[model samples]
Target: MSDQYLVRIEGKNTDIAVEETQSILDAALRANEWLPHSCTQGTCGTCKLKVLRGEVDHRQTPEYTLTVEERAEGLALGCMATPRSDLTVEPLGNVSDDGVPRHPLRDYEGTVVVLDDIAANTRRLVIELDTPMQFNAGQYAELIVPEHAGARQYSMANPPTETRRLEFHIKLTAGGLSTDGWIFRSMTLGERVSLRGPLGQFNLVAKQDEPAILIGGGTGLAPLKSIVQHALVEDLVPELFLYHGGRRREDLYDVEFFRDLEHRHPHFHYRPVLSEEQWEGATGLVTDVVVSDFPSCKGMSAFLCGPPAMVDAAVKALKRRRMAPRLIFREEFAITPATSTAPAVL
Candidate 1:
């Protein structure tokens, strides 16, 4: 079987070899070029492109991630999408043949520092890198598990600092390999793991004076939390609202920490929405709560994270509220066969 294909990005004057099983974003990033992307898991539409030529198998792409019009226009997500032919595409945003920070991939060693529960289905993971590593907020790294052939990806929940301590919010999916195999119960302090990356194009792009909107579902809060703190510290946005959702009250963890952030910064606000349980705060889906707060997200840059469905619905809702498609950013924690599908046990 043909395992590779050529990709020519329009206006970029860049042509790179893309493997049949590799993501275009992966190839670009490996080549030291930044593409507008996040999640890199086929959930975020940031890597969306207009396919001028060639074909792709979007079977693994989430239905909620792209719109019908986008599909009709021959668009596809670069992360989960694989080239089926020699291809050419027009990238949407956050790109340039030159300009913007491009951190070349590097390898590092790290020891597990802390593994504590942060929510009902989530855990707070802290890793102490042997050497200081740099990465933009919202970027993730692959944690190589000894028992697995492939590395599992996790987003850093903290902004860049001089320290090597990185944080992550890991959700223990039912029958999850890493969760069940090591992360949840078996992993121990001082355990060493191979780390590579500072990967993905999910970094923040601060637009002056525009209010930033962030929404997260379940453990999807990882990168968004990173982005939020980074934005506030850098003064990236004058004001912002973060809406986090879960099935129950327990899922909306870290409420107090966020509330403290909001208290300290008048321009920043946090709202927790629960679907299954009633609360004094906003109820129903997170997207609905955001819409109810503002009829339209005009002049706002919206960042969404979580499962494919939540990210999709939020993106659509923001668009309907007159938010430009370009203004919305995302990362999908999709429940795909590769990640979330549990095997039948008899």
Candidate 2:
């Protein structure tokens, strides 16, 4: 059966429809509305809001982050909660001083359509959504695998225009939850799974004409790749230099894709770095490479996606080079199931 509801935010109203069983966050995101959130599995406080009127229920949530008093006071995390009746929600974004957008989290069921081993340790998986899901290219999704209470977050590897199909680059982690279903492993096509989001505030600023330095490490290359692809398609060709790093050559999955991008777009430059080996390519930590290659980012903006360590390192290096904190946009990819916990405060 289907459920319908009216969501009122900031004097604007939107009609949202959802499957009777889906969460409000899933439905709202499916409709293509911006929502502030991170770690859609209830870990990031970005989607929290006040229920001005009406009732809701969160089927899967980390209640530890919220006090019983808070829930009783009408506080809820939209990504974890589902509307049970017509609702008037004071979207988290509307009351924020930072201007971050709080969008509804939408749900989708996608079938694993293809899986390709792009590198020795990284595999690319393609899922075809039952219906098209619109989102900015760099946004991510929380994939819920059956039999596991936890969710895994991953960024899309394809351009937004390719709505029905979503691509992801997965790196095998020692104890990763989704590692059991690796694209290069025994997982088969046609297996269906549930997903939530289009979560994240990382996207291109429409009017910003600053040259962008794109930094990615390991499978973190997924979102950066999508952003670059979308940037090209949208004709926002600010001088771009993409630097991707890995421990060895095999970790740089889809390496050829970036090479082709540089060839196709004259304004693009590609740098692939391997730290543990001598392959005659750029050699050093990715951040160090950026420091030695483009030391001063005085008038440039930087975008980064990777492990927390890499993200932190890149941010520090950029700061030393005179890049503003506001000029650096980033998305840190969370891989383990347990890492998808919501924050106490957004």
State which candidate has the highest lDDT.
Answer: 1
How high is each candidate's TM-score? 0.77, 0.78
lDDT of 1 by residue, 124-177 (tens): 989999988788888888776665645567888988763499898999978777
> lDDT values of the candidates?
0.78, 0.75
lDDT of 2 at 329: 83
Whole-model alpha-carbon lDDT for candidate 2: 0.75
Per-residue lDDT over 112-131 for candidate 2, one digit per residue giving the tens place of the 0 to 100 score: 98877788777788899997
Q: What CA RMSD would you report for each candidate? A: 5.7, 4.9
